[model samples]
Target: MFYFLKQRFSHLAIPEKNAKRIGMFRTLCAIFGGLCVAYLGMTLLLFILPVSPGESLVIPLLFNTLAWALASLWIVLAPTRLRALWRSVLPTLCFAVLIVFFFFKESM
Candidate 1:
């Protein structure tokens, strides 16, 4: 199953530009960068929202899951195309923001 998925994504995989094998630094950087972006985006949304304490808890969980699922799908299917990744990300972010805005507006 793993092999099949990898094969399907072979075209989207980045070609190694250097002879050096994957190193710890590169792996760490990728993980950290992804986490930082996710955290920063979530934090920004949390501040903009005016939810009650109980409601606020659910918002982060829902948004994070939705964002991560979308991001994971894009990473798996469009890895080679940075533009495709950005295009996917922007819409998801906008959707999250819109949801928050409406939720707050309705609560008021």
Candidate 2:
């Protein structure tokens, strides 16, 4: 079954040397970039939830673990290395911007 799937998806496979590089790239993105995105996501969740502070904090705190896990897997399992990089980076950047905007808005 695995072999059949591999053959079926042969066009998606990377060369051996590039496989290692892409794997490392995905791993690094999953760890560092995913974490950044997850953390910011949690913060954004806290801000977005229409609940009291204590309840909101608890929800994102719980969600952070699941969010990080999903983000890591999402990055690592993307179709290509570039896709993985974007999957990790784009969300992180967007979340960072939203977090900044929320903070700035709060200050104003």
Candidate 3:
């Protein structure tokens, strides 16, 4: 059974072991990276919104799911595994910094 399966899919681009590792890496990146990006993106959205606190939470919360899906898709579709990680990391960091500054300004 295993032999027949191997022979059936032998023409795949990546070698067997490497492909499995890469697939796992991509999956991890998508899951964790998407969460980071989505959470940060939602907080960042708070700064842009002009509504009161009660109403403001609603929009970002609503958009969170959609943002997570898009971020996950973006990372998965990246040409290289590392690039997929970077695509998620860079924006997350940017959002973090912006949130920090917003809070700092509010404190001062």
Worst 10 residues of 1 by lDDT: 75-84
**lDDT by residue for model 1 (1-108), tens:** 999978755643554455355434334333443444455456556656787656676677667656655454444343243434454456556656765776687689
After superposition, which runs of candidate 2 have C-alpha atoms over 4 Å from their true positions? 1-22
Worst 10 residues of 2 by lDDT: 11-20
Candidate 2 C-alpha lDDT tens digits along 1-108? 999877745633443344445467678989887788889999998777888778789888888888899999888877676677778879988998998898798779
Q: CA lDDT of 18 in candidate 2?
A: 49
Q: Residue by residue across 1-108, what tens digits does model 3's lDDT show?
A: 998768644533234354335576677889889999999989988877878767899999999999999999888766566676678789889999999998798789
How does each model score on TM-score?
Answer: 0.38, 0.74, 0.77
lDDT score for residue 9 of model 3: 44
Of candidates 2 and 1, the better by lDDT = 2
Task: Give residue 81's lDDT in candidate 2 (0 to 100).
Answer: 60
Assess candidate 2 and give its TM-score to the true structure: 0.74
Per-residue lDDT for 58 in model 1?
Answer: 66
Evaluated at residue 35, the lDDT of candidate 3 is 90
Cα lDDT of all candidates, in order? 0.53, 0.80, 0.80
Error of 1 at 81 (Å): 14
Residue pairs in clash, model 3? none
